[model samples]
Structure formats: structure tokens, C-alpha cells
Target: MAETRPVWVIYDDGSTGHMEIPEGDGDPALAKPGRLVTEAEYTARLEEIRAARAARHEAEETARLEAARADYDALIAGGFPEATARRLSGYQGTQAPAA
Candidate 1:
């Protein structure tokens, strides 16, 4: 098996603060009793973090676009053309969004 190492972290302060260093490689005094993780575990954790971040960004963008579409519709209903409504409401789509 590949060499594994400690991932130093103390979560009592309600903040994310972790340092990755192999046991006995870095100063022992600086390390908080952390968990030992394999390289595979570390890489998997990184992928999970990346996926969660992407999902969050996608959800945020979907919400923003939905809001813009609503604004565009409201402007159109209030006597504006499709182009004018989209322009005024910052809607990026050229056609009405699918229901």
C-alpha cells in the first residue's frame, strides 16, 4: 500500500482549518491530534469538495436565471416587448424559458 499521513485539524472553533502533513515529517508541536488518511482518501475528499462546489454554483445560477425570467415576464405583461423586457430584466435567453 502507498504511504499514508496525518491530516491535522481541530474543529472546536467552528472554522475550517486543516493542514496535510505526514506524521513525523512536520513539527509535531504544531499538529493537533488529526486523522490519518490514505492518498486515495485525500484525493476522494478533494473530488467530493469539487463536486459539492459545482452543484452549489449550478443551483445558484438556476435560481438567478429563474428570477430573471420572472422579471422579464412581468415586464412583458406590463406592456413591454419581448426584447425590451429581456433587456431591462437582464434575461440572457432569446426565447421564453420552458415551463
Candidate 2:
């Protein structure tokens, strides 16, 4: 009955769905059947959204890793052990501890 609250109903197929019942006005069409989207359609839509998000995440991760690699390379060039450099190269976090 709240203005922004959503009304949900369980279908016979065991699926839960929502109907927005506006507090001030209720449309008669709300009782009518809702639009049914195909499974593949929903899957494709979600996949596209997830792929875009993942692409951005991968780009940021790559930038961070490359920066870390550069720092490790600098350490190796400064006479640090290859093992230490390799360990620093693979570390993933906000800040790397002093070697």
C-alpha cells in the first residue's frame, strides 16, 4: 500500500514476480497479463551487461598489474633477487610491502 513499495506474487510455476501498485492510482491494466520475455532474450541481455562490466574490470586489473610489473622490474634492475622480483610482480592489493 506504500507509494514506492512493490507488490509481488508467486506464479503457479514457482516463479516470483512483481507488480507496481501505485498508492495514488491503480490502473485496471495492472490486472492484465504482463509481458513475457523469452529466456534467451533475458540471458542475452544479462550477458551483454555482464560482458561490458567485465571488460571494464579487466582493463582496470590489467593497468594495476602492469604498474606492479613495472615496479618489480625496477626493483630487479636495482639488484633485488629474481625470486623477490617475481614475488612482488604477482602480488595483488592496494599497497605492496617493502622488501
Candidate 3:
């Protein structure tokens, strides 16, 4: 029986995926335009990719919050009701009172 191992499939455009293949398969369809890597290296790279995605999500959330705050302030300044402003800004009215 042939032993199967995890191989990290790296694409030319810098994307990555994984597959399990038997040792010495070396199929051109799987090897061309993509490099195979050890499981340990694949795991480490996956962690780095996940961390980067998390950081980007956090940053986007922060920006969204900032924009919401600006909209809330503008609504308040325009004499709209506080509850209505909160709703428009995607808040649940449980947020701390605006300064």
C-alpha cells in the first residue's frame, strides 16, 4: 500500500490549498505551476494567513465603527431623535451616550 501525505498546493497567483496524495505520485497536473510543501511548513503558513485575515477584519470593523459614529453625530447635530440616529447608524441603542 502506498503511503499518503498532506501536500500544500501553492498556486502561481499566491493562493494556497492542500491535498493528500500517495508518495511518488508526482503527477504533472498536481506539480506543474504549483509547489508541494511539507506539512509543518504548510501549517505555519496557514497560521500566518489566518492571522493576516484576522487583523484585516479587525481593521475593517474599526473603520465601520468610526463611520457609524460620524453618522450618529451628524444625525444628532441635525436634530434627529437619539433613538432614530442610533438605528440609522446600526447601533442597538444600548451604546454609551454620545458625549
Candidate 4:
């Protein structure tokens, strides 16, 4: 049977999660009071966190782009110059459909 232990984490963003880990290195980012893991657990957790972060970043970027597009369209409707609107809104694409 594999060994496991209870670990509580207090994160910087005022968040927390439960882990079956042990106190090892004094790393703040790992686990509160810290925790150790088996090679298998480490690898699996590493992949999981990476995938989660990537998905979150992609979603954020998509939202940012959408907001920028909205801003660009609003500015153009308000009679702002294209260059000024693009500059302020962070939108570089042409507003009209291709010919």
C-alpha cells in the first residue's frame, strides 16, 4: 500500500486546499507547514497544475480580447478615429468584414 498523510495549505491569495502530503521543504508555495510527495504524486500533480493554469490563462486572454473588441466597437460608434480607437482599446483587427 502507498503511504499518505494529511496536509493543510494556506495560500498567498487567502485560499486553502487539503492534501495527502507530508511536511518536508520549507517552501511557501508547496504546502502550508509544507509537504512531501512521492515521485508519482509529484509528476501527476505537476501535470494537473500546469494544465489548469494553461486553461485559466487562455480563458483570461479570450475575455480580455473580447473586452477590447467591445471597447473598439464602442469607440468607433462614438465617432472616434480608427487609430485612436485601436490604440486605446488594444484592438488591432479591422472592424469590417473582408471584401
Q: Which candidate is the best by TM-score?
A: 3
Pairs with backbone N, CA or C atoms under 3 Å apart (clashes), candidate 4: 22-35, 22-36
**Alpha carbon lDDT of residue 96, candidate 2?**
48
Ranking by lDDT: 3, 4, 1, 2
Q: Compared with the true structure, what per-residue lDDT tens digits does model 4 show for residues 15-93?
A: 4455653445343357344354455655666577778889999999999988998888888888888889889999887
The C-alpha TM-scores of every prediction are: 0.65, 0.44, 0.77, 0.60
* The candidate that achieves the highest lDDT relative to the unseen native structure: 3
lDDT of 1: 0.66
Of the candidates numbered 1 and 3, which has the greater lDDT value? 3
Q: Write the per-residue lDDT of candidate 1 for residues 1-99, one digit (tens) a residue.
A: 435455533333322234545655753443344454455665666676788889999999999998998998889888887778889989978786443
Backbone clashes in model 1, listed as residue pairs:
none
Off by over 4 Å in 3: 1-3, 92-99
lDDT values for all models = 0.66, 0.61, 0.76, 0.68
Candidate number that wins on lDDT, 1 or 2: 1
User: Which digits, one per residue and each the tens of the lDDT, describe model 2 over residues 18-62?
Assistant: 555567654324344444344564456557667888999999989
TM-score-better candidate, 2 vs 4:
4
In terms of lDDT, which candidate is stronger, 1 or 4?
4
Give the candidate order by descending TM-score.
Answer: 3, 1, 4, 2
Model 1 regions more than 4 Å off:
1-33, 97-99
Candidate 2 structure lDDT = 0.61
| Cα RMSD for predicted model 1 | 5.6
